[model samples]
Target: MISHTAAITIYTKTGERREMAEATPYEEQRRRQVEANKRKLEELQLHHLSAAIREAAAAAKPSLVKKRKARVPLDVADAVMEPVRRSGRLANLPDKPVYREKVPDFGMKIRRTYGSVRRDLTNRVYATDDARSYAISKAEDLEQELDSSFPIFIKPMTQSHVTGGFWLGLPIHFCRKYLPKRDEMITLVDEDDDESDTLYLAMKRGLSAGWRGFAVQQKLVDGDCLVFQLIEQTKFKVYITRASSYYESED
Candidate 1:
């Protein structure tokens, strides 16, 4: 007796023809579920709803794109130049004048004035030989006692100093260092504790006006020497050394 059985044909890469059989029960169930989902979507019209949403989104999208602004040209007639700002590092102040020491030039001739006449002091004599020697020794002894701790200057009496103009010019360096820079009345204290007011001429750097009174009161002559010690501002302790000629003339 002959029996019939369901079987599938197979194919090989060697050019043999083949037939595939229907899927198994499990695979068939999965295929039916997929077909059921498709039918549900069709009934609900989900594809048409999605198409409408896409159309609405496209309509709502902004149509204008952002662009850079165009440059505007300026007319020459309307253009204006701005003033330059100065540097902040520069101080807003007047220029300071340079300070220089007033000094006489070299090889320049200096003339001493005695009232109306100009005199040459080159061959001038201060005192006799013995009198000058005594004054020098006394000054040396006094300087040794002070030891330069105080400011001191010596002025030998001249015709211009004791008579005529009666103007006494102190050493330039000493005036610059120890004296006032303006016209003022300075006190002169003698060895007897007597104080005399004398005028300090800042411009000429000399003593004027009242100096004649001090010279006359002290009996100062053309050969006497006076030592000025600055004891205070605008005050001097004056020490005098009279010449031998003065004593002779007095006798």
Candidate 2:
């Protein structure tokens, strides 16, 4: 969690001049929930795997009672679930939620920030680091805008967006005006300031779930959703809301 003063430092460094902002309490609570959920999912997976192995051994004559997981191929664990993701396999395929964790809900509000035992997830992220670097080398403009902006609102994504999936493309601009270096950490924060904000770099490492990835996120209330707006090219805005905004199109 960031102190209010720290939040301001990030802003002033970027070029925001004394604009007061704070992330809401709701944002911080949800962010913590998501993190806790990810950690617990790993624990559950270990238990699930252990139970299965134990059951297999208990069989009177265990001869390949279980098809060896080797058939699943060897994989490195990542922070966000992929491969075995319980949901949203279509949009972010190949890379899927390794484990599907639960976003707990109670009635109309969140029963808890992050839920339990929905699925398992990997602790290590894959391939995304390279992807971010490639994206950054390709687009500099988007980086600058985001760097200067500091904390912008984000729409919490659903299982459909794919696990470990956040944003894609946008215009390129040199970021020296805001970020000291193109690859330097770019901070994204909520104007409300409850400390749910995250610092990220568009190109360098980009943003995703992993030790080196962005930790900032927004968790939705029971009915709310996040919308992705492509600011330019692949640089998009992940906006949060109760539901999608519907405006009549010009006939």
Candidate 3:
């Protein structure tokens, strides 16, 4: 009885497995279809053909080397922050030259010519205060004694006119009005009636040449005043007022 029951249990489990298999016909059919396709691929030798194509493509292609990975931005950040380096050749160049201007020397020449009309070693003379005052008074007296019809011009003498540079510059207005426009010989008649010939330079507006002799003979000095009365076109009647101490001494 135990053997029969054990047999019965085995038979029952076999029957349930058979029934489950029969119920899933679609799964069994799909599995059989996949097996049949694999058999067909094997019969056509398609698996071997695919493997040959892969090998042929690999053999035709060039070999590739593995590329190194790119560096991160932070890895080269210090190098980017550093300043640019200068060329080594620039350090050997010479420095640029500086230029300076030379100063002039004029002290010696100025000392020799200062206050000199003729630029000679002779001492320069100026009129005394008393002599200038006396000459002006004497000039007014001489102007009144001259003829009223004739035009008169007065001049006060200086060292350049009477001594060192005997060059006399006449009044510009007088030369423009009464004197000739061209240079000519003019006569100077002193109070003694002695006549002297002098060149009147229209350009210079002064007496030249014969004037030195007239100035010497008149004994004219600095601060002396002279009155010139134009009597004719080229003739002048001259009167002198001396600045001598003799006149003051006499008074």
Angstrom error of the Cα, residue 156, model 2: value is 12
Candidate 3, pairs of clashing residues? none
RMSD (Cα, Å) of model 1: 20.8
Clashes of each: 0, 34, 0
Selected candidate, larger lDDT, 2 vs 3: 3
Model 1 gets an lDDT of 0.72
Candidate 2 — worst ten consecutive residues by lDDT sum?
242-251
Flag regions of model 1 displaced more than 4 Å. 1-126, 245-251
lDDT of 2 by residue, 1-251 (tens): 85543243334666876744565787778889999998998978887898889888787565666675543333444434354556775656755345753322322332122222122235322223333333333233333445444422233333322234433222234332323343222232222332222223445433322111222234322223333333332233443433222111112
Residue-level lDDT tens digits of model 1 in 153-227: 887777788765778998999999989898777788999998877777888899875677787677676767788
lDDT value, residue 129 of candidate 3: 74
Candidate no. 3 TM-score: 0.49
Candidate 3 C-alpha lDDT tens digits along 1-251: 32211111223644753222232566678889999999998999998999999999999987697778967587476657543438777555544444642223322221112123332326444668787768877888879977889989999898888887677889999999999998777788998888877767788899865676777777678888899999999999998887774367568
- Ordered from best to worst TM-score, the candidate numbers read 3, 1, 2
The TM-scores, one per candidate, come to: 0.46, 0.23, 0.49
Ranking by lDDT: 3, 1, 2
Model 2 spans > 4 angstroms off: 1-164, 167-170, 174-177, 197-199, 202-205, 209-217, 220-243, 247-251
Reference-based lDDT, residue 212, model 3: 69
